[model samples]
Target: MALEDVSLHIEPEDIYGIIGMSGAGKSTLIRCINLLEKPVAGEILIDGNCIFRKFGKFFENNNEPELMLQGAELRNLRRQIGMIFQSHNLLMQKTVSQNIAFPMEIAGAPKHEIDKRVSELLEVVNLADKVANYPSQLSGGQRQRVSIARAMANMPKILLCDEPTSALDSLTTNQILDLLWDLNQDYKVTIVMITHEIELVKRICNKVAVIDRTRVVDQGEIGQVLLNPSMEITKQLLSGSRGTRG
Candidate 1:
């Protein structure tokens, strides 16, 4: 999906929500922030540093993209931005501890440091007992918790979550949301969550953006957008979200 003129300004330590129905381009917008998907004409700036800029409409055109960071530099920058997906995406063959240590190993961190950080993250996610367990042995929620621990292995300043709890039950979803809230408050990691569940946004997010048909129809503080939705699409979404937890 092509996102048109989609712009968002997320403040530090904010649990920002990007809400929309299926096929609304919400995933694309979030992926663009990490440059997993690049835009053709606009520039992406992280902490006021230009990541990518292009003037042309078509990315396949002859024009050169202004890549401020490429190769090793871009990889280093990605270290500061961690991504979580709907699927656990854990290595089926690796134990929880090994999975959590994967990112640090790729970055060439010292063995002792990786072990120490993995232990700390396991404790943070309240999965110290599951450190030796494989993804198949854990339940749905536990696997998600392990994934969360792995995403935090690098201590990223920003965490991009794409439907992190969409696969969990209601109780488990709330538990995950609470864990995320705690992480934001304790570690000050900015969270940008992509969800179709409006109630989930109200439960955890302070600010939100509503995407409809590949555009941001409404955005602001959670209270403002819910109380005074200016667009019809926003109102429809709100109405549809009632009684739906996931």
Candidate 2:
């Protein structure tokens, strides 16, 4: 899942989409941003501060040269970057409220604070009435909503979603997309979404990158990339995405 010379510029609060066929490194790219999967080389900066930087085999945290974040430092940094997976990844045995409160609990927030935050997040995801339900008691879309609330529990500045709606039906997909869009608009959370559905990108993303063979072959403003594509893979993806939606 290593990438080469893959560079993309994503602006603040942008719903940036990364589109590629299966095995094209889209998911890996998303994971790399959050350091779930570390890059072999390159720098990842957040708010213009270099959090991760590598040169050849050496890894360094830019704030302190020749140092790498470990233990609580790494965990604290990851808190500001939330991740949503294709699988909802909810705890099947935990109630929706408990699941959403997990991150806050881990962060050592008081029980009252966790409860308050969980209630607010549930309302944001429109699942307030399902607070006591377990993952097993919810539908696919509902489960995804729980995951979204959990990801937002710590009020992350950035959200990395890996095909968050791919498992749902068309109508459900649209619902999830709308929820994500609202989150971006309301909270101004930067979002990086990986999807094969170009239509999804068209509906929400302001910028896009097309990856091919572990390399970014096309990227830019969504409209510009779609209307004036420069690569065959981008063209093919645009065509196939249209055919699927049509």
Candidate 3:
């Protein structure tokens, strides 16, 4: 969690990948964007506004001043930027449709809109038939698809994935990756993914960033970085040379 001087701009509608071995700070980097782990020193701008500049100071003062947003600003930002993790993270008791509808329900979307959106999203993720199934009844890939549908329920502008395919078998991994590619094409949603699998980045990411020891060692177009890695750490990662797996 010691990210140092890491800075990058993700363009609109771009699929950016962060690649590194374990303990390489990839997860920390993404978490920093949402201030999940505040950087000791750095600016985090979202949509050109510096959200983290005074975060620490604001929390420290604790004036409890009546302010705008009612803490919903941060929640709204998170809603617009969806996240998927290595674990499917579905609620055990919720049905597939219920899981996909969870976010919209939290946001208080009207019932009609929620129903329409959930149906369309289930079809998009090819999980329409599993709407009534519980998490325990679905395969790993199906579970992940349910998670994806849930993440997209709010129509996020950006999607963050953390080692999304690490647990799946090779064939399921490929199918999931292809599904992600299709999602990107159809929705034009900006994606930022963290994974140790370089091949996944090659297949889906347009831009890549290599991190090591809490620092970004390399960043560029995937083709350029893969073909001619500039940093030693980047070379090691791209060459399939494992550092500690983080």
Candidate 4:
């Protein structure tokens, strides 16, 4: 239900991944990173700055902390981190460009700057032609691409993605993966992808952390924990694919 003592170090420009079985608290960790789901304890740091310092140290019966980011501090810190969900939480009523512009508008960016960034992101995502389109008018993969564009609108240093590829078919999954990989290379953004699929990690992530029972059981380079897996869950994750390959 909650992550416990999970500490992860995602290198800059690395495609880091978090994987586990359902109810393993991986999602909770992702939510915590973005401050979407407040934690009772521990602090989230981005590039040596404590973006959110939560204080539920002992998991008391509904007691709260005295200090953490608030108002402008919280809002400013949140701007540095961007999040996308598996469901592609886009504004159905807005056009693709408008959806990507939502965050900038909220931040009070000038209309000219918003127009410039929206145009740039559309090209980066290869959805320039779909700028006038709505979420309902695009394919699943296209919709996710738009979401990725939106997530990068502010040029965040870190991107938090929760099962962004879970809704796509195999071919489209790879396409989205390629786009993410390109984003990492081009923008030098650190990407943290959360998923249940081991193959997804193997294919894209250079580093990974495995979560189980609200705790991180394994974490390291892909070759270590994933390729030559040491933990039971890691072995189990590789088992099906290994079996298939064998």
Candidate 5:
């Protein structure tokens, strides 16, 4: 794979959006942040720690032994970051509450604590009554809501959304965006979303980045970048409006 240079700083409480075409490398950029795709060059910093550059070598071997992490440090880092995907990735056999509670269970939260957290999450996503319903019973939008609840189960400081609204209809997309905005306001969680939706960027994103050919072409405040797009590719994307809308 060819190397691409990209850089951006997302502050806490900011809704950062990355827009691009299907092969524009949006997915690769997000994966690089979590060290899921190791970049041959460049640095990825999370909360001031250079996690990628510092630990890049650790991922060299797919079968590398898992090193014991100091309990508090590992817990703190993992609990502070959350991720949600377009697929909803819910357990078909599990109930809504159970799916939302899965992460907390993995982290070894007490039973009472898990229950309370799940209740709060369901309320946040407006799925309080569907707690007992399974994924098979919920609509695409509802399923995405459940995924959001699960992602936020640990009250993460940073939330990564990879084409989160791609499978939903317009109405549901708006609802989900509103929910995310609400979360940003209520919890001050920094949201980094990867999508091909120009409308979505105009609607909720305060900061926007345009990626093309495995590199970021332009990025800035939404209003400024949209008004005076610095890159030709960005102007083309905006003009054609061929990107993903949902």
Candidate 6:
């Protein structure tokens, strides 16, 4: 029960950021959206579908069972949504190409198609030359780029990033943010990023939600909150946020 009464909307083609302190249920909220962390109540609707809403006795038919997605149905839905972690969860033993192609391979894509898509994704993430390289051979930033490519391998409608750039330095973080922006523009993928850095939000996010103590204290267009913060936590976060974004 990390989150309580937390709600937010993310539009298509959005790079939405969820900003908060370390223990503010930021990860829990994002995980709930993907069904990683299930909430006891509340409906999480994506594309107007309530993924978490229970059925059975709660549905219109009293005798019918819960209309929950399971097996292939759930897998198919998950395929349409991609998620990346704070750590580069690459296959250490597999080459970069193989890691990027892992999901497509699992979904039974053809060898030729996997190869072709891997090549295209590598190019997109600017890692074409490192196709044969393993995760151990790449730098932190390069590994993150490869993870991003893998996340997009399925051409998902939504991409969930959990502290995508927290491990990198300021320069590399900026680079990764720029890459995310490029992906959002090119693929029209809706992005939901979880982060503790407000500067990161100002740099990339269009809409944002600030969470604290399992609750969302403030949220709206990034411009509004950044320019004029209202809540005490929001003001504190903004005050500590470094740099002056243009």
TM-score (C-alpha) between model 2 and the true structure:
0.93
Off by over 4 Å in 5: 1-3, 54-76, 243-246
Q: Model 1, range 1-246, lDDT digits (tens) per residue?
A: 998877799998999999988888989999888888877677788888888887665545546556656788788878889888899899999999999999899989999999999999999999999888899999999999888888888999999999999899999999899989998998999999999988899899999999989899899999999899999877877887744434
Residues 99-144 of candidate 4: C-alpha lDDT, one tens digit per residue: 9998888889999999999999999999999999999999999999
Could you give candidate 5's per-residue lDDT for residues 1-246 as a string of tens digits?
343657798887899999988878788787666555666645566877755442245345454333332457655666667888989999999999999998899888999999999999999999999989999999999999999999999888988999999888899999999999999999999999998878888889999999988778899999999999999878877886653332
- Root-mean-square deviation of each candidate, in angstroms? 3.0, 3.0, 4.3, 3.6, 5.0, 3.7
Model 4 spans with C-alpha error above 4 angstroms? 54-66, 241-246
Model 1 RMSD, rounded to 1 decimal = 3.0
What are the lDDT figures for the candidates, one per model? 0.89, 0.89, 0.83, 0.86, 0.84, 0.87
Clash count list over all predictions: 0, 0, 4, 2, 0, 0
Better of 3 and 4 by lDDT: 4
Candidate ranking under lDDT, highest first, comes to: 1, 2, 6, 4, 5, 3
Report the backbone clash tally of model 6: 0
Candidate 2, lDDT over the whole model: 0.89
Candidate that beats the other on TM-score, 1 or 6, i.e. the better one: 1
For model 1, what is the C-alpha lDDT against the true structure? Answer: 0.89
Task: Report the C-alpha lDDT of model 2 over 1-246, residue by residue, as the tens digit.
Answer: 778887787889999999988778899899887778887777778888776776654434334453355678789988888789999999988999999999889889999999999999999999999999889999999999999989999999999999999899999999999999999999999999999888899999999999989899999999999999999988888888746434
Per-residue lDDT, model 5, residue 192, is: 93
